[model samples]
Target chain A: AQTVTQSQPEMSVQEAETVTLSCTYDTSESDYYLFWYKQPPSRQMILVIRQEAYKQQNATENRFSVNFQKAAKSFSLKISDSQLGDAAMYFCASSAYSGAGSYQLTFGKGTKLSVIP
Target chain B: DAGVTQSPTHLIKTRGQQVTLRCSPKSGHDTVSWYQQALGQGPQFIFQYYEEEERQRGNFPDRFSGHQFPNYSSELNVNALLLGDSALYLCASSSHMRLDQETQYFGPGTRLLVL
Candidate 1:
């Protein structure tokens, strides 16, 4: 079984600044994927960015980037030049490479991010 | 393209009653997955349906059942609903059952209130 953990319950960052949300997971599988999802006040879950375990280089999506440390089982999301619109509940998810629709995802508790003006 | 959609944006029901939520997968998508998200918590996988059959399920009880139609639309049925069951129910759809790069696109979700 895979378990994802987000130690930070809440985080805040000033406008134009940057914020990093921490995430860790426990899994025996060597090949997998990690994702960061954002849920705004609208209650819609939006995919932010994704990282493939096979890729040593982190993934970057404009203002969103990730620092994926496979050895440490850590995958953190970094929001650059944070804007007020970035304020939301961020969840970290892990998915193993498998069939049987076992491609299920294990998610962390989430970190509530607040962008300050 | 039309994204995944869920019907009855909000619903209210009394305990011990039954409720059914519906979902339509994204255009060209054949797989539908359901998730439950409680307040202040991340979404938990409920089940996935493909070919009008349940392909995988999470740890939820049997009281929580579902169905998939030939149109790729799905329904989640919860019997003897409890107050604890009140939460946001999300529907996601993916293109295929492939082992790699299978990203699920989610709907806005239906908010269920078990009074």
Candidate 2:
């Protein structure tokens, strides 16, 4: 079974600053996918970014990027030029690439991010 | 285009009761997955439906069941509900053609409170 862990329970960042949310996972599979999701007070879960385990290069989307360290089993999310809209509960998730369990996602508890003006 | 959509934004039920939650997959998507998100916790996968059949399921008990329609819509049914079942139910959808790389789009989720 794969388990994702987000050690940071809460994090805060000033507007226009940068912030990093830590996440680690224990998986025996060599092929898998990692994702970061954001849930605002509106209760909608939105995809922030994703990283493929086989891809050595990290994934970046707009202001959101990921530091994927396969050897360390670590996948952290970095938010640059953070804005008020960035405040939300961030979740780290993992999934297998194939087999019957491919559709299921294992998620971490989540990190509450606060953006201060 | 509209993303995934769930019915009954909120629902209330009692112990030993039954509840059914509905989901409409996003346009062009052929797979629907259901998840349960406890308060202050991440969403836990319940099951996934593809081609009107259950393709995968998580560690949830048999009390949690689901159905998928030809239109790619889905429903989650819980029997003998307990107070522990109170949580937000989320529906996610994605295309099977690119299942490995495609990201699942999520719905606003239905809040179920078992009293």
Question: What range of 10 consecutive residues in model 2 chain A has the weakest lDDT sum?
Answer: A95-104
For candidate 2 chain B, which ten residues in a row score worst on lDDT?
A: B96-105
Q: Pick the candidate with the highest DockQ.
A: 1
Judged by lDDT, which candidate is best?
2
The CAPRI classification for model 2 reads as: medium
Report chain A TM-scores, every model. Answer: 0.96, 0.96
What are the models' TM-scores? 0.96, 0.97
Residue range with the least summed lDDT across 10 consecutive positions in model 1 chain B: B95-104
Q: Which stretches of candidate 2 lie over 4 Å from their true place?
A: A98-101, B99-102
**Candidate 1 overall Cα lDDT vs. reference?**
0.91
Which 10-residue span in candidate 1 chain A carries the lowest summed lDDT?
A: A97-106
| Alpha-carbon runs more than 4 Å astray in model 1 | B97-101
Q: What share of the true interface contacts does each candidate keep?
A: 0.60, 0.70
Candidate 1 local lDDT, residue B102 = 61
